[model samples]
Target: MSVYDDYEMTIGIECHVQLATKTKLFSPADNDARDAEPNTKTHQIDFGLPGMLPVLNKHAVELAVRAGKALNSPIAHVSRFDRKHYFYPDLPKGYQTSQMYNPIILAGYVDAPLEDGSLKRVRIDHAHMEEDAGKLTHHDGYSLVDLNRAGTPLIEIVSEPDMHSAEEAKAYVSELHKLMVYAGVTYGNLYHGNMRFDVNISVAKKGATELGKRAEIKNLNSFRSVERAAEYEFKRQVDILERGEEVVQETRGWNDDKQITISQRSKEDAQDYRYMPDPDIPPVVLTDEVIAGIQSKVPMLPGEYREKWSALNLDKSVINSLLSNQDYAQITLEVQEKSGEASAKRVAHWFASALTASDNDTNDDSTQTMLYAARGS
Candidate 1:
């Protein structure tokens, strides 16, 4: 047996999901900056101008409540924000407003379904509200900072180190993304930075009591990248240990072209951030009525739809294709309710065939045609 066979890997993930709010987290700036000029979407609060104070956005809180219901977690009636001090060119405020001691969403768990029809339960430690930093672009000799993305509302979902393999990590992220999207919490556009993942990976000897030092791969935008990075990092750590060296605890970056992890900087502890309660913003206090009102807006989740469609006995691939788009899943369910099981099965097969013919293309035109066809029949 290979030396690598005697080792085990552990992984945890932190995801930053941008809330689909109309404005920035604490300012009246335009939230959608896809095609705007570099700094046009920023406001005084985002720029951290003097004498500027942040006003809490109620819509963001409403969405967070919906998110809590989707995650099968409880919403904290009282949660406060703190200041995480760090220096970076993109952070105009020099400190990020986040939840450190108390977060909005409490402990939760996600039953991620594996390919073999087994479920891996991943525990969520917590999810906190925060604002995003700006984008930095490096040129030949200088770097440009764009504040367009600064101060955008985000909920960072942090999971426990419960995942044991790369496949589990991928499955967990995919389920999390679906939950967020189906709940109408965020746009769930991975390419547009609506959701970004930071994967923390560690390796240890089989049956060892303690886990090895971990290296975090930051800002991964795709699910495949998460799985590939974990696989590479585990091997890298195992090789280091076999050579009588130790794995360094640091932040790393994924080279998608090379399929390798590169060290970026040493990881810092919480004390390094100098966390302090924010003096400007007050604590978020929600009543039972408010939470119930917001949570009522949450739509059917992927798991619920899967359970509803399980009676059809369709292939797993077909079910996954239907669940790819919210409309498709909803239509399939509606057909089952209106017509009968046989009709719904036919509709499901039609959607699966269309998706396969289009190479799983989810473009608006194709989606519209499918919706029309499903409605007509």
Candidate 2:
């Protein structure tokens, strides 16, 4: 065994992004699930009422299509929905409506630069649409189900195993969360249950040909806890291997208070989901015109926006800070539009420290929606 066994770690993260739609993806009912009249936001579709037809929210579709374009993925002209057979107290329907065999976005990449001055292009296997499960609220050691979020729109982003450390894994998740926030596709609030990550970790020898078995860290609620969970898992695996034990592929949970990952269950196989086309809904046929319309709505994406200001004469720290929070990019653009290129440079300088202190994406999706709609989307 080489020392690299302790140092070399491979990681891949799957992020669950909850889209910011005013209403449920397939129902016209308002989507204020967290704070609304109890069950008032829901409709027949969410309740799985018999013969209830699912009407695809065109806005949600447009947002999903826009996201696919931003990720530079090949859009599935005609996407299909499947039913993931599962039984949970939180799920009213026997199955979840999700995109599986035919996801709208396929094989994308997110550019995550490494510490070695080399850019790591994170391979995105797919970004698929799915309805969120209802929130489970536990009271007095018993759980109560809330269906408000049952039918909320969500997209799951699966990334390739391109990371080597827990920190890198955390960075990748942060980058994606920020991208979604900046794009106005998601709120990016991990605590609000708006974003979640299921992380995979494995170990390898210095010169081994085959990789070690993998363990998944499920439901890492916040970004801060992700690295700790991965570290504990890595140590657990290393100790098990040192004792001549095999690493079983299983799912674990991060105990943030205790700073460890406890085994939850053996990782389930794909067949467990029993994925099949949803018999109730037809295919989500995406027209070229609709695709083009959504594509046109994609403004200077995060990368493009950052590059546009990278060369500007500004403080390095300021540049880094602005790049971190995308509001800085929009603020710069606003400064430029209202004034000139020189003024835009000034805007970056002015917003650097102030924006860094706030520690949130100040910009919201409504600003873009109004701006884009005004441009005739």
Candidate 3:
């Protein structure tokens, strides 16, 4: 007899995390590689050079598995890659390598805060490893494609349609972002396009087995967009239903400038993309020992860190700043290790002040940067 009596909103998310690797997923371009000129970073394999062999990036696999464990997803002993066939200027190979049938991480949950001071569990369906497509820059009259990102390693974490409200969906994304930040998955800087999310939303009557029509909002780079887009869609669809109109299933693009979701195409009109196994790459067979070892390598994560720090009732501002950046979390832990747990809060306060305040290459640079590095050292 709550809000459920009026409506039910089901939600799912697909979050793409770029691996912070020293090199590209398959090629040798530096991690977070950027090229000013189009197709400048191209390698034969990256350029879809004929008969080129792909050697799996060892670090990419390990980081994917490690992050999967942090998400509490079961490790798949064997995972395979698929060819998602599509044609776009940004796609150098005319296809993308991703996991479709089976993924690296199976099932998990991300706990999120609720409006009632309770917790809502965001169900994670799977987290799969894949390669990112290139970036397309559109000019006034033409478009150019940059291949530097063509082969970058990306881990796509998908969630079940378990969320019931826009707020819940936002918290879910924010929590996952935090977990990724702490685990070194990616920088989660939407402004820089380091991490991005796609939201799938559907609204239904309070009691209904059949779901209402759905719309997909693509590449929402910011957490605010994720929530606002969902809320906007919910209202738009609900209004349609109230007017006794049929809501068609379709994919849409977010017009960030207008703060609205615009239809790209009806779902049925979209291409199949003809998924098939990649003929070039071999199946990923992860042994049990390797899985366990990778799991062991992940230290206590954000949830655990939060629990341990709660006893001190630390300042919310300090906690917010610490959680804002994963690097700060790591620094806090290191400072605690060196200064002792009893004095951890005091050390963290000073560190947070410096990190949030100053810039590099100034008078306070050497000493503060050393204090920052000393925690890790």
Candidate 4:
């Protein structure tokens, strides 16, 4: 047996999902900064100017409610925001406004399906609402800060350390992404930083009762990166333990080009941030009726669609392809409802064929319209 077989790795993930709202979390600035000029989409609140106060976005809260249902988690009847104090070049206020003590999403679990048809259940600790900081662009000798992304709404989903393997980590993140997208909480665009993941991983002896010190890999945008980073970190930790050395608890950055993780800085604890309740914003209080109204708007999720399509006995690959796009899944279900199982099965195969032919470009508007036309016929 390999030396690596003697150790086990534990992984937990924290995802920052940008809310698909028209305006920033606290400001009236445009939230869609893609291809926009720097600083043009920012507002005074984003810049932290004097006399500026943050106003909570109601739509963001509604989206969070929908996200709660998607995760099988309960929403807090009353949630408050706290200021996480930190210093960074991109932070204009020198602190980030976030939900610390009372997060909006409570305990929940996700049953991620592995490739071998087995399920790995991962627990979610909580998810909190926060505002994103500005972007920093570095040059040879200087750095520029663009506040366009500052004050953008975000819900940070924190998962428990339940995942053991890198593949399990990848599956969990993939399932989480689908949940958010199908719930209409975020746009789920990885390229544009709509959903970013921070993986906290540690390794220990197989029979050890306690988990070893963990190093966090931050701001990974792709599911593959999460798996690769976890695998690399696990081996690195094992090597350290094998050499009679201690692994340092620090924050690391993934070098996608080099395919390695680089140490950024020592990870800070909660006391370091000196969390305090924000006076500018009031606590978010929701009634049962409000939550029911918001969550009722969440349409069918991926699992529901899978259960509905199981009766057709289509190939697993075809079902997976249909689930990749929300519109495709909705169209297939509509066809099933309108015509019959046979029609729905044929439409699903056609969509699968079309997706393969186009190389998985499901964003073609004209082509999507034609596919929707198939539902009617």
Candidate 5:
């Protein structure tokens, strides 16, 4: 066996999900800031103008509570925001409003289904509500800052160091994305950066009790990128250890073209952030009744969706394809209910074939109705 054979990898993920709301978290600026002219969606609060105070968006709070229920995490009756001090062009304010002590969602577990049809439970540490920073684009001469996204609502889901393989990490992220979209948490828009992942990975000896130093791959925007980055980082760390050198704790960015990770900056510890409670915003007060109301709004989650799809007895590939698209999944379920199980299979096949033939978006009701008509014929 090679030197790498004696090691195992451990991975923890920090996932940021942008909440789908019309307005920003604290500011009234439009949350659909993507594609808009730079800095057009900004308000006084988003710009951190003098004498500005934040007003927590009630809709964002409700969505966060609903998200907690979807993740199988209990909602906290009281959760507050804290200031995470950092300086960057993207950050209009010197600090990012985040949660340090109390968070909205507590401990939970995600049952990630592997390719072998087996499940691995990835334990969640906590999920907290926060405001996203703005976007910075670097030009040859200078960097341009867009404050439109500065105050967008987000829930950062921090998972325990539970993943061992790249496949496991991919599965967990896939399941998490499905759950978030299915429960109306976010739009699940990858291109628009609706969700992004920060993967922290470290390797240890096969029987070693302690883990080696970890390097974090920051802001992985795609599921494929997350898996590929983990695989690359795992090998990189193993190679370093084999050379009798220690892996440095740092933040790295993935080079998609090179399929390698480049060092960005040294990783900062928690103390480096200088977390303090935001004086401008008060603690969110969630009562039992309020939480119950939010929980009631959560619809069918991915696990439940899988269970129902399994009963249809369709091909596994078809079932998976359907499950990933909420619109298609709902239409398939409705067709099954109306036409019976036998017709459901025929309709699904027709729908799948039509989609393959046309390469059209299945999110529209018209496309589904056309498939239904074709099935009837």
Candidate 6:
């Protein structure tokens, strides 16, 4: 039997997404911290002032509901915020306001594509709303805190341990990222840390009923890192098992430079965080009319766009490029509407070429305007 026959890997991922809201989750401070100076976007509420109160952002909730719809998840009409106590320099409040017992989004699954051209449905355990902590930058011997991100809105999507391979893990995150971005829940920018993935991996004997000790790789910023880290851990754990060694249950960090996982600390359970219902913030009560309104505003997702563009018989790359970008997809639809169905193929080619020439600059309003003019011409 092959060495691989002796072991199987089980993987689950926790994805943290920064909501695309204009203000912080519980404060009126600006939420977009991309290029702003450190700590400049913070407010008194973000700093955990004694008298400051937590106010939920309505836009953030609407975006969360939109995301739930996109994920095929049921949205809870009544969701409450709790306080998760923790101590760190990045967290000024000592406790983060989050949803624990009742999350906004319920169980859902993402149909992720595999490398073998097959689909696997990854079940989502839950998606909970929370406030993000600050950023800590370490200098030579000191560290500085940036509270700009402290009160930012975040949704942590926890997945069931259904993925068995690195490809599945990558695909699951990729699909999740696409859905969140297309649904306008988040910008899904890895560079700005709009989304981060925490991968929990474990191994088992081919016919074992119970799973082996698992290690969580935290804060993986890219899909490639998730794949590589999973693969690396799989082999590492198998090797340990071969030597009659037990895998340690700990939290690890992905070393992109070394392409390996480094142990961070022993994993902590939920009780360690001291979760308690927050008395300051009231439970969010959503009426049927409000939920229906938000659902109505949900746009066509990437999967729908794919099905629509596939009928055009255009190249798969072209179809995917357009679907991956909202502006490109809008331009393609406009072209088909204004120039008739016959002009769609030529316009798709031109649009793909322009996208390539423009380096896929989605922020260029002028380029989009020109495309509209050309389609009308």
How well does model 1 score by local distance difference test? 0.93
The residue pairs in collision within model 1 are none
Q: How far is 212's C-alpha from truth in model 1 (Å)?
A: 0.5
Candidate 1 residue-wise lDDT, 1-377, digit = tens? 88889999999999999999999899999999887889999999999999999998889988888889988899999999999999998988899999999999999999998999888999999999999999999999999999999999999999999999999999999999999999999998887999999999999999999999999999999999999999999999999999999899999999999999999999999999999999999999999999998998789999999899989998988888888788888999999998888989999999888776344445678678878888767
Put down candidate 6 lDDT per residue, 1-377, tens digits, no spaces. 76866899999999999999999998999999889899899998988879988888999999999989888898998999999998988889799899999999999989986656568999988899999999899899999999989989999999999999999999899889989988889988887899999999999998899999999999999889999999999998999999899999999999999999999999989999999999999998888788889989878887777666665787766765666667767767767767766677777777676666235645668676866665574
Model 5, range 1-377, lDDT digits (tens) per residue? 78778899999999999999999999888899878999999999988888899999999999998888878899888898999999987877799999999998999888988888899899999999999999889999998998989999999999999999999999999899989998999998887899999999999999998988999999999889999999999999999998999999999999999999999999999999999988988888889998998789888887886787677777766766776677667776777777787767776676665665224334478775775574453
Model 2 weakest 10-residue run by lDDT: 368-377
Better of 1 and 2 by TM-score: 1
Alpha-carbon lDDT, every model:
0.93, 0.76, 0.78, 0.92, 0.88, 0.87
Residues 1-377, candidate 3, lDDT per residue (tens digit)? 54434777788998999887877777776556653466666677788877777767889988898788778888899998888888876766788888888787889988886556467898888998888888888899998878877888999999999898889988888888878866767766666677889899998898889888778888888778999999888888877887889888888889878988999876643248788988777888989998998778776676777776776577756765666655566667766767767567865676557655233123455655756565754
Instruction: Name the 10 consecutive residues with the lowest summed lDDT in model 4.
Output: 355-364
Q: Which should have the higher TM-score, number 1 or number 6?
A: 1
Q: Rank the candidates by lDDT, best first.
A: 1, 4, 5, 6, 3, 2
lDDT of 4 by residue, 1-377 (tens): 99999999999999999999999999999999999999999998999899999889999999999999999999999999999998886878889999999999898988887888778999999999999999999999999999999999999999999999999999999989999999999999899999999999999999999999999999999999999999999999999999999999999999999889999999989899999999999999999999999999999998899889889998878987888888888989999998999999989988888677244545668676767577786
Q: 145-221 in candidate 2: lDDT tens per residue?
A: 77888878888888888887877777677667767776677766676778899999988765667778999998887
Instruction: Give me the runs in candidate 6 sitting further than 4 Å from their true place.
Output: 337-342, 352-358, 362-370
Q: What's the lDDT of the predicted structure labeled candidate 2?
A: 0.76
What does each candidate score in C-alpha RMSD? 1.3, 4.8, 3.6, 1.5, 2.0, 2.2
Among these predicted structures, which one has the highest TM-score? 1
Off by over 4 Å in 4: 357-366
Score candidate 5 by lDDT.
Answer: 0.88
Write down the TM-score of every candidate. Answer: 0.98, 0.87, 0.87, 0.97, 0.95, 0.93
